[model samples]
Target: MSEWQQRSLASLGNYENGFAFNELHWSEHGLPIIRIAQITGSQGIVDCFPGVLPESYRIDEGDLIFSWSGTLAVVRWSGGPAWLNQHLFKVVPAAGIDRSFLFHVLQASVAEMGKRTHGSTMKHIKRGELREFSVEIPGNECEQRKIAQVLDTLDTAIRETEALIDKLKAVKQGLLHNLLTRGIDPNGQLRPPQSETPQLYKESPLGWIPREWSYGSLGTWLMGKPKNGYSPQEAGEWTGVQMLGLGCLTKEGFFGAQLKLAPAGDRGLEKALLNDGDLLISRANTRDLVGVVGVYRDIGTPCTYPDLMMRLMPSEETSAEFLQLVLQSSKVRRQIQGSASGTSESMVKISSAIVTGLKVAIPKPDEQSVILCRSKALDAQLQSELQELEVLRAIKAGLMDDLLTGRVRVTPLLKSLQQTAAQTGA
Candidate 1:
């Protein structure tokens, strides 16, 4: 019948709890201490100690480790050699199971373990409960390895794709900083830095910019007094008018494709309906995200923003696209954040006075169009890459459920891969 046998996790591996290195023992540069946050995220080590601990408590790259409390996560310690701190379990295979197989099994159990965790605020997994967690593995070591190989390949791919996405985001940030400061020339090359092209750049209230680009206060570009939105009155199923929230805006730009329809005959419902080329700024939010900005690309149906946000209509002197970029740029973001006032950490707000009076560096309409077009192209690339990342994560999540749970076995797929490799001389 089935070659697989159910085994308690304790039988497959010996577990060692991490040493409780107190906060007093921390250091800047010494033996890196692996804490709970590190085990879950497990990025490069930070909190370190100068001294050494028992050899059993130490861990290095490729070691299988788990955080037993706070957050339950099984990780292969690849963040470099470090000392394992408290609330963690360093798993060492006893004899019967493959190391990678044990990690994959535990990784699959994280969700269940999280559910069963004790503590109302800070949950923890009991040692006995962790030791008793079970998984079925084929008795044959070859099959065990094949299964681990399949899961490990997906893990590797997911990690690499995540790293790539991070790099793409960093690149996009740099592109925005450079392009927004130095507008693209008609030749398509970026204008020289301020240091190199002093004549082309002139000092302004905002900063140095192309001499042709003159100072323009946000007021000059404003069509009228900034209008705050009307909040929906508990309109769960009401479908008369869609009401936009701060959530509709993202740093990547407007996700206005979806907005909750507001309650009927709401105050300011008529005036709040978003017009073409309206720039909405978050009048209130967290300190960092207080001035989050985006343009209403185009809403085909009836749409209006909520009280949490304000709409700024631009004049002929400025393009909505250009104003949107300026508002999102670091130069303007600093002003927005500095102007925001909040009583509590949970909520912060900026007044329309601060927004309308904020200074902005404006370019000739044609030059602004050039900068807008180029940034749009870069933004399109970023969005496409982001979509691919989403798909990869979804695929990985599905594979983990099926393959790890034995719903979809890898033995046959492994054999097929081996055969294809042999045929292709790979």
Candidate 2:
């Protein structure tokens, strides 16, 4: 702590805001105009700028960029040379400052910057406000590098885990599509696609499916009517009854993190109470998300679904897990989205008729079990990696708080490493 000193962002670096590139300046082929949306990953850089601009506006790989409006985030640019758009600042670290350390510190300061933002629609901090934001840093550049090295290691692991998770998800998606169409053979292997082995498949309303599969409307496999859930006024206090939000049912499946407390005394509450393994579908949402399905797993609390969702129970002939996975298939998803109707494009509704009438290829119970077992195996791997990611993030957050604040000194750690290296060389 003795070597650490508080420093303002302006003192450690020059913050250069990018030029405002409007639609008129957008071109199809040229250097990308990096926007805040592109930094946040909500949008890609489709439009580029052909005209050369000032050197200050040109950002290359390994530069530090801070998006100051809407979303406050600090990113290390990894893409090729491009033009920087408005509301973003290109940070040039001072001679004594470690660029990597400065990048991590800025990321840690985003929440503080967010608190000082103005404007109702799009929040932004003035340059003066940003300049005053301070953080504690060690005066020694060597100590700074040590701290940055520790964080960078964790970041590398996090990035690799994220990449692996994405690849696994893509593989799982392809496998799922195959299982739903080509299906598992009697020997417990994926049947070859119709393109490779035409004799194994037959034509159906849904498309070419394995000969062992039967095609029919979803209603034929349902135990009873698809009941709509209940919605009551949101309770300010915990009333012991939790209601699932529209976000709870995602394409990946049920996520209870977005739950809201509901009044237990609501008249129709009993009807909406969910049982473990109960399959749910969004009755109303955006066209892309309207018919998203998930199964309610016990969260160790009494929870109910809202009116925007519908509950279904599969007949003895159907496996609930298989049905939930099937609903996520591109074919079934298209049917659900295609049948959806609403006055606003942002919000749409899918009725029971549409859900029941959607065509599907049903596999035998044993085959369904085999398919689910394999899918769950992949899902388990994804979830494990996801959990590892969460832990790594939490660890990074803690390390940044300690290492950056000088609470957990890296000077001693650095010396220990240096001694170990010398001994090894000897």
Cα RMSD of all models vs. native, in order, equals: 2.9, 2.5
Return the clash pairs for model 2, or none: none
lDDT of 1 by residue, 1-426 (tens): 187888877777888998888779888978788888776664757788878678888898899998878777888988777898878889998786789988887888889888789998788887788566787767777777888897788777777877877887788788878877788787878899999989888888877888888676788888987889887575778676787867887776678765786876666688788876778888888888887888886667778888888888888877777888888888888998888887885688999899988888887888888888878887787677778778877876787777666677777777887899899996
Name the runs in model 2 displaced over 4 angstroms: 414-426
**What tens digits encode model 2's per-residue C-alpha lDDT throughout 86-140?**
9999999998999999999998998888887899999887788766888999999
The candidate maximizing lDDT is: 2
lDDT of each: 0.81, 0.90
Show the colliding residue pairs in model 1. Answer: none
TM-score each candidate. Answer: 0.89, 0.95
Give candidate 1 misplaced runs (Cα > 4 Å): 40-46, 238-242, 256-261, 264-268, 275-277, 297-302, 415-426
